[model samples]
Target: MSKYLPLSERLARETGDQWRPTLAEIEAVLGFPLPKAAQQAAWWGGASDKPHHRAWLDHGWRARDLDRAAGTVTFHRDPTAGQPPPPAEAPPVIEAHRGVGGMALIGAGVAVIAGVGLLAARLMKGRKA
Candidate 1:
């Protein structure tokens, strides 16, 4: 089954294309990652039969409602009353630093300790001699 339904018969009449956005497109527009379960629900049809298609439609409605509430973009729904509020904006992205600063500090500390130990050993040997 297709991940998205064809534009509603009414909408198709108004809009030129039967174009419907996929689950991935919706997530992209929202600029966030959805939970695995929600993603599954949204694309369930991408792998299976008619029920998955139906599930995608049902969950897609909820997701679209959330996107609208977050003010990411405007969307219209048929009959309109069942719409939910927009979802919250996506959280900021995290970046990991790959610099060796931490490792370098540890290496410097180890070297200092080793030098102190060697100096102490040499002084003790000199005293014994």
Candidate 2:
């Protein structure tokens, strides 16, 4: 079967928006019966994982609103390939800085408290009162 078809491109151009093509029509353009994969719904899922989707996908057409019971698939020109996510509004960044002087002051304060605690402990241990 022909891997690609001119009809797909022509249809995308002429239809300009939505084109519902029957399976028979697709096969006719392809010049052969579609492979078994075509019968699978995923074949028209607009995902690029399968080779069968390439025929229409290459022409920038994507499947939409697939109706399995009705045996119909709507193809739409998806040049955007789905639009990109809207730009995120990031939270403003906050910078915190502790200078060497600030750290040293904290350390000194801890040491003074420890010294006082030790002195008090020693005095209480030595005295009856």
Candidate 3:
């Protein structure tokens, strides 16, 4: 059996999906396209046995460790540096309609109050004249 048999079988059985690459199958599933150097590092045994990928293991290079695992290869960062942090999440967007509706309601209220006050003032002034 190929070294990737277990990973291929697991991916097929769990996700009902098949990926043909002999190496880096897990990375493909995770949507992280590994660089050529990373792939080679993983192929040479620098990652973990798990399906997940990490840039380091035991605070050291794990490229060689990953090479020994069956199924798909994993990539690891060199011992000198840790993996970069995950990308920042975008803030949720607020729709404009709600804000516009609030502003419209306030404007309408002010207009009605001003109209009523003007009518009351005119009536009082006409009575006095």
Q: What is the TM-score of each candidate against the true structure?
A: 0.26, 0.50, 0.27
Off by over 4 Å in 2: 49-51, 82-129
Tens-place lDDT per residue, model 1, 19-86, is 24554654564455534554433432233234423433343321233232233322333332233447
Which 10 successive residues of model 1 have the least lDDT summed?
60-69
Candidate 3 lDDT, tens digit per residue, 1-129? 334344334443433222233455555544555446544544444335433332223233333333424545433434442345468998776876548878999999999999999999999999999
Backbone clash pairs in model 3 (N, Cα, C under 3 Å; residues 3+ apart or in different chains), count: 12
Candidate 2 lDDT over residue span 1-129, tens digit each? 536555555565665678887877766776777667666667677456455566566677777776767766688887754344479998865555437678989999999999999999999989966
User: Which residues of candidate 1, in runs, are more than 4 Å off?
Assistant: 1-99
> Residue 94, candidate 1: how far off, in angstroms?
13
The deviation in Å at residue 41 for candidate 2 is 2.1
Q: Pick the candidate with the highest TM-score.
A: 2
C-alpha positional error of residue 114 in candidate 3 after TM-score superposition, expressed in Å: 0.2
Q: Extract clashing residue pairs from model 2.
A: none
Error of 1 at 34 (Å): 41
Q: Comparing candidate 1 with candidate 2, which one achieves the higher TM-score? A: 2
User: What clash count goes with each model?
Assistant: 4, 0, 12
Candidate 2 overall lDDT versus native: 0.70
